[model samples]
Target: MNTQATPSPQFYLTAPAVCPYLPGEMERKVFTHLVGPRAAEMNDLLTQGGFRRSQNIAYRPACESCRACISVRILVNEFKPARTMRRVLAANSDIVGTMHPAQPSTEQFSLFRRYLDDRHQKGGMSDMSALDYAIMVEDTHVNTRIIEYRKRVPGAGIGDQPKGELMAVALSDLMSDGLSMVYSFFNPLLDRRSLGTFMILDHINRTRTLGLPHVYLGYWVKGSEKMHYKTRYQPQEHLTPRGWERYAEDGGV
Candidate 1:
């Protein structure tokens, strides 16, 4: 006894290009635009279907003969911290993250510039200007937010919140199942913070606090060092042809 109308989504495939994660390998993607009045609802469905949103575009791997880009999500309640992850948490104890509207800021762009210059100097987005960065943050049709991380300012009291110069930023999407971290960057000079891992751990904790199920990490390429960290979030599931299947720790079928 249910009557409802579901919106239809149109899909497109991108031309093959060099894979960012795996060198020499080609990458192709099946993508669709997330727009119109039903954008949020459509986003929820697309995410569940293994697509990740970037700005207003939702995309997933569509390689000719490779399936390495597996969509992953941590089962938050079941995630237990490993020894190394505990160390990372301890290392970043002085950093506090504040979630805000997805509106971009000049300070964030400055941090973004430093990060790109230090880390991804030769990557595709290396040439992006402040305007491009702003569009990446603000050009969205679905529910999105930005989490700003900063050093905890020395509070003269115990209960006071931290307020310091911006150290990192993560543009995230609010999905029904969990939050999807669209993109993130930090002050590359602060390499000691292990900010990348710290952010993921923080998001996992945030999801748990929100009583959500998973944190949809975009993709994990098996042999990619940059993506290998994603596998450490145990009790995670991967999107396979069958469905979201639990990842085997032994790296087997």
Candidate 2:
């Protein structure tokens, strides 16, 4: 057996706050800062333990008396597209996503602004400016990348990569076992494309291409309509008191 030493990271708990997903419920988090040389390894460990990254912070739900938030990740190798998902893939065939080092751009911020305005006007990130957006994308020590989606030009030939108008963006983490979707946004005008679902689908395909077995989709809360879509990806695993196990489709909240 090979032996390697890694420093232990300190953890903290946040004060309880109003639950964003479930009404009439309070939510709290146990979080740790991801920094220094071992940030990447620490991040991977925490993520596998059900923590999610936001900029340089890794956090997981630590609510009192509530176990509604379940960490979910897709089993990519075992996934099969449903009829509706296939249709979504075909509908977005004209779009392409290019992965790049995590960096902020005016175009990306513009789309992010529109998406926030249209979908989450009164949410926590509504007041974020361009600089804050930049920090969100770049202030990280772990392996992070952004995938920018755009529509292909009419005359563009095969193997010709072009960066057109930005349509959607996914901020993802390349972990040891899978790609974790930290956050994502899309052009509000292209709701017809269902860019949200398309982004997840694209990540699944990307994971397959990379020979990764899973795609981390973050947490799913029971009784939250906003989180219901996450359960659509079948053969997924959820972190439990025992450990990660296959999620039951009919598993009640």
Candidate 3:
């Protein structure tokens, strides 16, 4: 057998589709398959350049005349939870998130199904089956983990594991410089708990505890109410033509 190195990654642009974030606009994406031995390194590089990962694909928006999807990353060391955020944390103090190896299970799928049904009933992922969910959770070559949030159960001892009702889950990657949140879902019934905001706050705290500089929140689309919440995390940086810069409220994208 002859020894040879693998070829460099080749990217492809997706066909334009109706924009989901903005009305009457089209959206395109530049995507590449993340596989092979260098997948982790390639993922890190692409992500730092403003790409987001979904399962085995790494992609970034390529919409012409539309720069709405801006990459947002929080400065973990400098971040301080706002008053509301503090309240969200206090509200969920009875809950805790434990990091577990990226794995799939029936319990996780049940929560995921419920979240999708309640939050994104018409979204593309609403119909994802359990097997598809497994691929999403386990098909990875990078350093990733699932942060499972649930009502805190009194533990037996220091070495014992937490046993709580599954309420939320976040799939994230630990990068050399930061933590990239791939995806997150929470119990829709817990409206008062504000689990969504609490999850982001927890990620920021986790990033700080890990000595990481940033916590990536994926793409924040301007003009989309769904993405506006990302701006709540103060002192965030947005990737621009001049590279990552301090985000200003006036910044449209």
Candidate 4:
């Protein structure tokens, strides 16, 4: 006859592994499951505290002495798209991103596989199967959506429009502060379009349309060229030990 609620879940840490973003360094993770009735609230707090979501789990870097991975979010209202970003917006003017429920599809997996093979073949998820990709997309316990971008089909570009083949996909979490882009990948062949930059610009516009103030871009490793593209989004705030500090090419005060 013990009608008591179960105790809240506790956090756990994982052993160190070779850091992906940096060489000659190891990385560990302090993580917890985002589950149950309180999961949404839990997720929000952890994300604000600089944790990134993966499936139903939330994790943050627990490196012993390194602080390379700093979380970043665009200052949406303050963000003035640079000349290059303006070109990206124009380049993708024919593409439309439709947000859908967090459900997996074979088409998505196909694009994901091509992306991994072309771009991140040596990364951790190189071996992820379709099932793993599905879990990544559908195992969320909080508000999540998949934004699939494709060419605007002729005659149906507006209003309940059906689309063309998928060009890119972003798995995003709807947070109280902003939209956290969990993961995104596109056809690598579209390098000229700079689909990666286009996606971020698209998200910034989407956030503005939703009246949101920021668009979370996850960690920006200090010395990684692959991560440098994130800094191009001007007027971004970097989560530092002193807290979220706004920065420009001249650095923040």
lDDT of 3 by residue, 1-253 (tens): 2222257877789999999889999999998888878888988999999999988789999998899899999988988888999999999887878898999889999999999999999998989999999999998888889999977777545455668799899999988888999999988898998998989999999999888899999999988999999998988999999999988666633
- Runs in model 4 deviating more than 4 A are 1-9
**Where does candidate 2 clash, by residue pair?**
none
TM-score of each: 0.93, 0.95, 0.94, 0.94
Which of the two candidates, 2 or 3, achieves a greater lDDT against the reference?
2
lDDT tens readout by residue for model 1, 145-236: 99999888876354665578798899999889899989999988888878999999999999999999999998888888878888888989
Please give the range of 10 consecutive residues that has the lowest summed lDDT in model 4. 1-10
Off by over 4 Å in 1: 1-6, 156-161
lDDT minimum window of 10 residues, candidate 2: 1-10
- lDDT, ranked from best to worst: 2, 3, 1, 4
- Please identify model 2 stretches exceeding 4 Å from their true place: 1-6, 251-253
Best by lDDT: 2
What does each candidate score in C-alpha RMSD?
4.1, 4.0, 2.9, 3.0
Cand. 4 TM to true fold: 0.94
Report, for all candidates in order, the number of backbone clashes: 0, 0, 0, 0
Over the stretch 1-253, how does candidate 2's per-residue lDDT look in tens digits?
2112236677778899999988899999997788888989988888889999999889999999799989999999999988999989999999989999999999999999999999998999999999999999999999999999999888888778855778899999998888999999998988788899999999999999999998999999888999999999988999998889998688832
Candidate 1 clashes between residue pairs 3 or more apart in a chain or in different chains: none
Instruction: State which candidate, 2 or 3, has the greater TM-score.
Output: 2
Error of 2 at 48 (Å): 0.8
